[model samples]
Structure formats: C-alpha cells, structure tokens
Target: MSTATDDGTREDAPPTPTKKQRRAAGIAEEASGGIKLILVKLIGLGIVDALALYAAFVLVMHEQWLVTVLVVAVAALVNWIYFSRRKLPAKYLTPGVIFLVVFQVFVLIYTGYIAFTNYGTGHNGTKEQAVSSLMASSLQRVEDSPTYGVTVVERANELGLLVTDPDGEAFVGTNEQPLEPATGVEYDGDLAVSAEGWKSLQFADVLARTDEVTALAVPYSEDPNDGAIRTPDGQSGYLYVSTLEYDETAGTMTDLETGVVYSDTGVGAFTAEDGEQLLPGWQITVGFDNFVRAVTDVRLAGPLVYVTLWTFAFALLSVATTFFLGLFLAIVFNDMRMRGRKIYRVLMILPYAIPSFLAALVWAGMMNESFGFINQVLFGGASIPWLTDPWLAKVSILIVNLWLGFPYMFLVCMGALQSIPEDIQEAATVDGAKPWAIFRLIKLPLLLVTVAPLLIASFAFNFNNFNTIYMLTDGGPRDSNAPIPVGFTDILITMVYKVAFTGQTRDYGLASAYSIIIFLIVAVISIIAFRRTKSLEELN
Candidate 1:
C-alpha cells in the first residue's frame, strides 16, 4: 500500500467505491439528473432548513409571536419549494418564478366570488370597508367643537372671555360688550389670541403675596341658533354631527345637504324611502328589486325586448354580410395579375381605420331626416326619417357596422387565402371544375376552417356594439307601451346602459349581474361555435 500525505487525508477513503457503491451512485445520479441537480437540491434544502431553524428560534424566543413567525416560516418554505423542488412541473413555473402563487389564485377566485354577491359601486360596501369606515368615524374625537361660528374658552382664572368667530360668521361678543369676568374669577391680563391658541393668566397670579391658585373657570351656554347646546356635566357639550347619518334604528338617514332620506335594508345600499331616487354618489343595493322591476315593469320590458331582438338580428346579419363581402373582395384581390392591388386593399381598409364612434356619428348626421346631405341629394325637397322611424334606425346601424366590419374580414381572408396551397386549386381546375365550383368545393370549405374563429369574434363584437346604437337613435322613437323604456334600435348593451345607469337611481348590482350573465352567454356561444366548426382540431 502507498501512504498518502496527511493533511487530514485518509489513505483508506474506500478507494473510490466498491462495485455495489458505484452502481448505487450511478442510480442516484440518473434519478436526479447530474451534479447541477444535486447542487440545486442541496441549495434549496439549505434555504428551507435555515429558514425553519430561524422560525424555530423565533418561536422559542418569543412565544407570543406565533402567527407572525409561522407566516414567515411558511413563506420561506414556499419560496424554497418554488425555487428548487422538482415535484411540480417546470412549465407551471419558470426561473425567478413567483413564490406567492397562492395569493394570485386567491385573488382570481375572490373576484369571481364577488360577481355572484351583491357587491358593486351602488350596493353596500363590503363588510371590511364598512367596518373600517365606521371605526374611522367613531374613534375621531373633535377637540374643540364649531359652535355659533365662534370659539368660547373658560380659562383657569374665573374670567369669561369670548373670541370672535374667525371664520367670518356673525359674532356675539364685540368691542361694546367685551367678555365679562366671572363673579369668583378676576381678569389677569389683556385678551390675546393667536393662530396657535388663546392665552390668559389667573386672577390669583396678579395678586401679590397670595398663595398660587389656579385660574377661575367660567361656563357659558352656546348660541341657540348654532348647532351647539350645553351639556349636563355643566363644563362642555358635545357637537355630535354626522356628515352622513345612518339611523340604525330606522335604517335611514336624512341627508343634511340634499334633504334626501336614504334607508338601508341590511345587505348593501341605502335607498330613498320616497319614490325619487338619488344619483351621482355611493350606490346602494335594493336586493332583487331591480331585477324584478326590470322584468315586471312594462315600461322598461317593452322596449328592452324589441331592442334585444334587433341587437341579435343585427349581429347575425352583420357577420353574414361581412363574411361574404370579405370573401368576395379577398378572392378578387388575391389574383396576382390585378394591377395596384395593394392600393385597392388599402382603400378598402379605410373604413376600419376610422374610429367607429366618429364614423357612426358622421353617418347619423348625413342620414339625418331634416338637414341630411343624403336626403337632400336623393329626395331633393323631401327628407328621410333616418332617426325617427324604428325600422330606418335599425337599418342605419346595420349599414354602418357592416361597412366597418367587412374590411377586417377581408384582410383576414386575404392572409388565409395565401396560406392555401396553389396546387390544390390547380388540381381542381384540371379536373374540369369551374372557378365557382373550385371555390365552393375546395376553396370555400378550406377558407371557412381558417376564418371561423374570426367570424365568431366578429359576431361577439357586433353583439355588444353600444356606440353605434347610442349615437344613432339612443334606442328611441320612445315606444311608450314597450315592456321597459326601450327603443326600436336598442341592443342589449345600449338598453342596459340607459335603464341601469342613465336613470335617477343607478342600479349597480343588477348591472354587475347582467354583465356576468352576458359574459357567460357569450362564452358558451363561442364554445359551441368552436365545437361545431371543429377549429380545435386544426389548432391542435
């Protein structure tokens, strides 16, 4: 055997490894990847172990800090696992990945939960916000109350000196009737007031060779016209005023400023007991009352139904017309022989380039019944009822939307058309298929597969196109007998805006619920369309 140099060296350090040890090491290395994996594992373990040890030390050192220590320890453990643990997949988290994943997941779930609850701008505040608001109001102590627009102070001396209201309110004490000294008290000095505070001396301090005595204290009643009154303790009275008063007993508050009486019925919101509703401030929930009113109230439902149907029909027709027009334009523009094709394409996309609101408004003005340019040109002396008539209003919305939407489909179709192999079309042509036959049998079917997603997207967009409906006729011609206050051209989105927010009392809870329901409807419809189109197979 050869002896090794001895700086803590062991000559018999097992001579590498036996066959069994070598096999075991190989197995471990394969299971864990390589040296890099082993190092990562060790580092992660070290971090967790160190944090655990620190947490244990904190727990032992400070028993009362259980929640804080445990929270810190758990956070460290999570970081360690997120950084190095191999149980979870890598795609779930990448390097420098966030360790507080639970927090994000919790927030998403909480938001979804709020959609179901009556939680919104108009509804009552959440429990936590309400509690915090109450605590803030209750704990606030007014040091000196604003009474009779003046500040009256009783000094240590028995002198009764009143200061004029610095806020420019009418004053009680003046130069003619200066503050009087109380019977038992004496005025020690001239009245002096500063921005800091009022200052005066006791009568006892002025008397020489007299034992030091505290100043006289005089109590006076506050002015009756003002909101202040004398207290039973005979020293000071509390000026209890609530800018927003909540009568817990009656669950109502008479707004001192607006003179509106708002009543709360537990869940969230304070509504005026009187028929008149308040606006432009905090919204209160009225439970299912808004929904009931929306459904049963004929004034709202009548117009709502008409507008809803028109909205759906418009969306459907818009998608169909835009698709066919776009396909036709794309096919024409796809020909390589067409001169200045790029220019034609750019000109076609001009409508899409313009803001829809501006375009819609401009279209409205041009189609106006009285002074419209189109009416003047066509009817000459006669004018058209573009906005007044219900059918005409619906036609106007569809026409403008179709003009705006087709360009987008045309652009998408052009790109998708280029992707189709030219050989496929040539083969069809060679097999005795005419141009329309080739397009219908080969091109159209293939194009549908590519453009189906965009079709669904376009439909969804048109369904909620509020700007077009709002600017055109505002859902009007005002059908008085309609279920709700609805217009001939009103869509769901536009109707919801007018009924829920435009009214005197904003109904936020119903609005939130309606939005959530609409979202669900759209999502379901899209899913169905995707399944029917079998676009997922193409994507996969």
Candidate 2:
C-alpha cells in the first residue's frame, strides 16, 4: 500500500513492517488481552466471594462453626489460586474438586452418619431441647391462677410478653429470656403496653400472629420448677406450671401428680419402670439396630423381602423387554428398502421426547381402574383393577415402564446398528450364511459390544425408578397387617421413602440404612456387570 507523504507526494509504504514496529503492535495486543483477562478474573472472583460470604453467613447463623470455617477457607484458597500466576493446574482443578466434595463426598458421609443415629421425628434434637419440649408440652394452668394483664411485644424478630403483675410490677420476657423487671415500661391502664427497646404489637399484629402468641411460653425464672407464663389471647397472661419436674443432677423427670420418677436409661428417652417412655426423645447412636431391624424385625422383614425380590425382577425384566423391542424396531427401520426412514425414526422417539415423570403421570391416569383410558376406552368399560391388584399392579408398572423406556433403547440401538461396517454383513451374505445365522453370530454380538454398558446403566436406572412406581401406583394395595405402612407394589426405594417421610412417625435412621443397603447393592451389581462386559470388549 502507498501513502501520501507530508510533501503531498505519493510514496510507497514499507513493503513489510519493521521488526520494532511489529514488536510494539504485539506488545499492545498482549497488554489489551492481559487487561481483559484481569477484568474477567476479577468479576468471576467477585461472584464467588459473594456466594461464599452468603454461605458462610448462613453457616455461622446456624452455629455450624466448622462448616463456616471451611467455606471461608475454600473461598480464600480459590481466590489465591486464581490470582497467583504459578498455580495454573490448581485453577483448572479447583471447581471439580469443590463440586465433587460438596455434591458427592458430603452426601455419602452425611447419609452414612444418619444411618447410625436415631435422627427422626420426635428424636431429632439434643437432650436439653427434648427436656424443654417435654416440659412445655406437659404444662397445665395453675389452679386459681390470677390473670396478669399482658401486652405482646417484639424485639429483633423475637416475640415477648410484657406482663403487669398483681402487685403492679412490670416485667418483660421472651421464650429465651426469663421474666425480668422492666425499665421504661409504658402502661395502658393496668396492662404493661410497652418496654424499652421493644415494640408493642398492635391488635392487628397480634391477630396476624395469633398462633405464635398463643404458643409462646415465657419462663418465669431460670429454674424449671418455677414454671413459665403463657398467654391465650395476647391480652391475658396466666401462670402455667409443668406437671413434671426435671432433676438435672439425677437426670430424672418426676411426674408431680403420679409421683412417678422417669430416669434416662441411656436409650435416648426418660423411661418409667413400667416400660413406658417419654415422647420427644433426643437422638442417639443405635449402632446396627436399624440395619438389623430391616432384616430381622418381624413387622418389616416380610414386606422388605418381597420388595427386594420385586425390585430385582422389575429392573431385570425392564432391561430385557425394552432392549429386545428396541432392537427389533431398529433392525426393521434400518433396512435399506424401508421408505421414509427419517419420519419413522422420529415417530419412534416421540415417547422418549416427553419427560419421564410427566409420562408416568399420564400413564397413571390411563391405567385408572374405573375412569382410565385403558379400562374405559381400550377395554370398553372393563374394570381391570390394574393398579389395585398386586399381580396386576406389577404388570401395569412393567408395561408403562416398557413404553417409557424402549424409545431410548431404540435410539441407541439404531445408532449402533447404523455404525456397523456394511462390508462385514455383505461378506457374511457371500459366505452363504442364513439371515438368522448372520445376525445371531455377527450382528447381535457386535450390538451387545456397543450396547452392554448402556444395558447396565438402564438396569441401574430402572432399579431406582421411584417416579414410575410412585406416580403409577403410589405403592398402594396397602398391607395393613404390616407394622409400617408398606404395600405390595412398594419397591425398596419407595419403601425407604415411606419409612422416612410418609407416616406420623418417620424413621430417618431406618430409611438411611435402607438407602445404604441400596447403594451397596447397586454398586456391587454394576461392578459385576462391568466386569462381565469385558468379554464383550473382546468382540470389539
């Protein structure tokens, strides 16, 4: 290119840039890139720091000191690693390590810990909390108790009662704080309407939080025997005393009316001589009791055994049925003579395109015994009891799962089939082998070589197929005779879910134990299946 010189004469520019000029241009580009990279890094680190700060704040508020420290430390380490020029590998590996620990290692460790404890409803708190809960639940109004004028107050989001005693002394108390003499107390008639640093709730506020106000029990003193003050209407406070007295030194609770002393037997609860135990027990380690209960407890053993067997059958059969059907469809459509192959392939995958959970729900409606599409329309109003009967429910689940699962297998098999070298099949044909012989000896083995791992994965998925079983039958056809609410259709996962969440008394420890067993079972099966697939690898 040419440029006009200062004298207005056309002159040729340098044919190539000088080394110094090129070096200067390269330096400028590198500087701009460095600035952009620094900006991006700072923005990324800022977001990470903000999230870490939030997580640390939450952990500290929950008194999880160790976790809060870990969060802060991790965030600091991340910032240091990214900011440092020397730690290139660390900057790349940090995210994966963090995610693996948070999502995998932590979950496995927590689940294992829960499996060894009685961390369920009524056994979810510390001993002190349990004692307090027990005492609060057993509170009864003192006979001939004089009503004190009360005003509901709040400070720092905590509800308190401003009480005017019979002698006209004003006191303020919250759930955490015992009654103390109030300063700067304002009165509306005899009622202690307000106190310093506390906002007296208006009638509307009291009405809005009626449940909270009514449930609030403010201690009259630090001593449990002294009782607490409670209000029903937020306007009148009554002295409600606990019927049980806790002896801290003895670790015993005495029923005042019955003169019965219940002592802590180290079984997590205050137990009486007659084998009766108090509710709201503290959590305790039970060693292998939960695991033992699953295998040996008379109430759970029979149902669990049946559920385990059924789970195996369901997973195995689901894999078999889906694979064969999908393989057949893929083979038929893969033929060169088949017209509109793309359209057929698309139609075949339509079921796979819908979300599994939604499909399960739709199938659940279709299989409804009375009003379902299957019984009403397909069977011309026949009452099949597809979900209610035990055998029939199993059949219904298998059918629905087959429908939901086959399309995925079909897509996989189609790709594998199409990828097989055409020359091998032609050579088999030229060798005068029958079609069945060629497929049986050549195609099926090769297909299995590619599809074996997928088959194992499919089995694992169907084994934990909670959505299909849950949405379809909800593990119903209830086995009332069993101790817990189990059903004929319940798989191991569904059974664990029911034990943990569905009933009035949730046994999270037992559920976690079941979950551990399930994990072990799946892991073992997968290991064996993968080892077996080594033979298939030889075919490749």
Candidate 3:
C-alpha cells in the first residue's frame, strides 16, 4: 500500500476533483433536467394537438372555417409557448384563456349577432339551405320509378343510403354523392347485407335518427331531376322528385304540380304572387327592428313595463326580508351568553345546504291547490290557489326565497360581526351609551362596510332569479292582455324565457334583445352600487 508517485505523493492519498470537472458535472445535471422537461411538454403538446385536430374537423364539417382556423392557431400557440423555455408564465395561462375565449367570448359575440337577425324556429341557416329544405319538403315519388330495398347508414353527422337497384346491383351513397356501384357488397333478401365503409343501422338506430334519414336524398348520377333514391322508413328507398323547382336564372321557385310561382322578396323568404310565404325561411339581418320592438311594440311594451316594476319590487323585498332575518339570527347567536350556538347555526343552514332546484320542486308539490299538504291537512281542507292566483303566488315566492336565501346572509353577517372589534363596543358600554344607540350609530356602519358589496350582489342575483319563478309559477296565472305569458308573478327574465321557448311563436331575436337589455341594466346597477359603497367608506 505504501508507494511513491512521480511527484512524491503517497499512493494511498486520493486526488482531489478539479474546478473544470465540477463545472462539467453541474452542466450535465442541468441538461438532464432540461431533457425531462422537454419530454413532459412534448407529451402535453401531443394531447393538445389531437384535441385541436378533432375540433377543427367538426367546425369544418359545419362550414365554420374561421372558428376551425382559430382553434388550430390557438393550439399551435399553446404548443409553442410550452416548447419555448422563456415563456414559463404562458404555460399556466394558455388553457384557461383558450376555454374562456371559446365558451364565453364566442357565446357573447354570437348572441349579439343573433339579436340583429331573425334566427328562430322558422328562420334558421343560409339561403341555399332554406331553398333545399323547401324543396325537400315538397318532394313526391315519381309515378313510374322503381322501389329499391335500402339500409340506412351514417357518415359523420349525415345519413347515407345503401340501396339495391332493380337489377340487384348494390350502390352506396349520401345526399352529397351520386349513387355508384359498391363492390364487396354482401346481400340478404334483395338488400345490402353489408358494405365496407357503411354501417347497417338497426330499427332503434333508424328511429333515433329519423329526421336525418328522412332528410337524406341520393341523386341518380348527380342529376337531381333524374329521380333519386329516397327513404321514408329507412328500409325501402324510392325515387322521388321535388314538386317545387327553383329557377336560379329567374330567381323564382315554381311549383310544378300547382303551376304556382314564388319569387324571392329579399326578406329571407320566397313569397307567392298571392302573398303566401314558404315555411322555414332563411336568417337575415334586420337592423334595430328587434331592439325597437322590445321598447316600442304595443303588444309587448305594455306588459313589459308591469313586469319590470314587479321584478324590481320582488328583488327588493326578497333581499330585505332575507337580510333582516339572517342578521337577527346572526346577532342572536353571536351573543356570548347563547347556548348551543354552533348546533343552532348548523340547523339554520340546512335550507341553504339543499339544492335550490329540488327545494323549489318540493315547495311546488306542497302548495298544490286541491290536494297539497298545506291545503288538505294544515288548512282543514280549505282549497286555496297558492300558485294560480297572481298576488298569492308572488307572496309564496317571497316566502320560499327567504327560506332559501337567509342562511347565506346569516353566514356572511356572522363572519362580519365576529370580525368587528370588541374594544369599540366595550368603550361605548363604558360611556353609558345604550345598546341600540351603539349598534345603530357605530356598529351598523362598520358592519355595512364589510357587507354592502355582498348585499348588492344578492340584489342582482334575485333580480334575475329564473328558477324560483319558473319552477313554481311557470310565469303563469295567465294575463290575457300581455303578448306572451305575462302575469303579475312573471319577472322580466321569465318573460324573456317565455317569449323564446314557451309559445308557438318563439322569437329568438326579440328574446336576445331583451337579454342584452337585462345584462346592461345589471352591469350599470352593479357599477352604481359599488360607487355608492365607496362613498360610504369615504364617509366612515
């Protein structure tokens, strides 16, 4: 073990590491960590790319190229940020920003766009689509056309037809493609047993996709006039031709069967010479008409005024009652002498703990006019129209809302009360000031400082409280004078919902206009309330 080196050092002593060696080791460790990070980012980028590809496919199928491009571009940017080393903060923010743009920003912009157009049940999609739909509706089977056995299939969101020609030749096609001979076709009972790309739809599948199957039309060699294969039962295909023929050069749709001609009126629909219009017109922009109708339509304006006032009153009363009840409960429990305060607080919160929708349904059953618990048992069989009568329904809504909303106010007020300083209250007591005086003059102001913003938020929430009004009353106890199902119990939001969905005339444009107004009103009121709260803070 004892040996001498050339430099006269003992062989048992080890050589120390140099500065270059240490530096090289540190560099290698950092490179290893960087490689791991790159791998994780690459995996994440792959998942994002796959999702973006699927989304782009869907949007492109719907002819929304702009949205598809935006999705792809955003996905690319997300990958880029994660791939780059300098943009660490963006890695965390990209997903949330993408979702916000897709779900919130796009929805708001689309809603605003719809408000300026007649996009409702009867008026939807583009002009060419409307024409095709009109023609599809007026189709009749050709008298001499042969009946072909068929099977329904699906491609993307569209339906396809697998039909056997009279010669027992199988052809597979969709509305967009002409019927072509299909190879490798398996046959059973004169119909297609199987096709390579097409799936044979069962009875249940056909039933579920009845609309799509009914809308499907496969052309005979791309000539629509040359009778095509159509299916009503999704099993038997027939050759049919549109009775209504559209002449592009003349810009007129002629009914070949009736000799009636309809010309485009530049108002989104084709109108006949006799003033009759076709069903399912195309969407078209009508500047300010919907907005004007919201404010000036004699039919809607009258009821809207009453509903607006009622909405205000209802919101104000609900907040007032709930806050007072909750505050009283909080104060009672906050007293140090109170016994079992925690248990009582928990019991009080049970109402708020239950889902509001379920609670509304429960209340609705309990308040039934003839056989409900309140009428049958509590009132000794006296029948009362709790929901059918307008005034009584309004009262019932307030009571139910108070029960549901107070616990939230109670919890907030309790937290605020606990946070208030004990020193100020003790000093007031020592100065011989009464409890009510100290509370009203000093403690109340301090409490308001913490609770005022919440109160405003509560007021806004109640103003558009759709579920309570809808589930209990359905905006009913029907008003004969109103345009749509307006009643004393109906608030503005409920009225808007009724206009959009409840009636035979679903006017989405007007409903969107109403929604925009509601949004503006809420936003302005919130801003004003916050400013007032700030003033109160300044005064204090």
Among these predicted structures, which one has the highest TM-score? 2
Model 3 spans with C-alpha error above 4 angstroms: 1-43, 146-153, 163-171, 176-196, 200-216, 219-227, 231-237
Candidate 3 per-residue lDDT over residues 1-540, each given as its tens digit:
467989998777556678999897776555435767678867988998999999999899889988888888888888777767566567678878888987999888887988999878778788777766676677788888888889887656667898888899999888767789886789887778678877788889899989888878787664444546798898888888888877777778888879889898877788997889887888999988899989999888789998999999999999899999999999999999999999999999999999888898899898999888999999999889999998999898998999999999999999989998899999999999999999898878888998999999999999999999888888768898776777888898999888888778788988899989998998999999999899668635
Ranking by lDDT: 2, 3, 1
In model 3, the clashing pairs are: none
C-alpha lDDT values of all predictions: 0.60, 0.91, 0.85
Worst 10-residue stretch by lDDT in candidate 1? 209-218
- lDDT for 212 in candidate 1 is 22
Residue 59's C-alpha lDDT in candidate 3? 95
TM-score computed on alpha carbons, candidate 1:
0.57
- lDDT of candidate 1? 0.60
**lDDT of each residue in 1-540, candidate 2, tens digit only:** 899989999998878989998997786555435878899989999999999999999898779999999999999999988878667668779999999999999999999999999889889999988888888889999988899999999998999999999989999998868899998988777777889999999999999999999999988887777888999999999999999999999999999999999999988899999989998899999999999987889878788889999999999999999999999999999999999999999999999999888998999899888899999998999999999999999999999999998999999999999999999999999999999999999999999999999999999998999999998889888888888888888899999999999889999999999999999999999999999999988887
Ranking of models by TM-score: 2, 3, 1
The total of clashing pairs for model 3 equals: 0
- Model 2: how far residue 392 lies from native, Å: 1.0
Residue pairs in collision within model 2:
none
TM-score computed on alpha carbons, candidate 2: 0.88
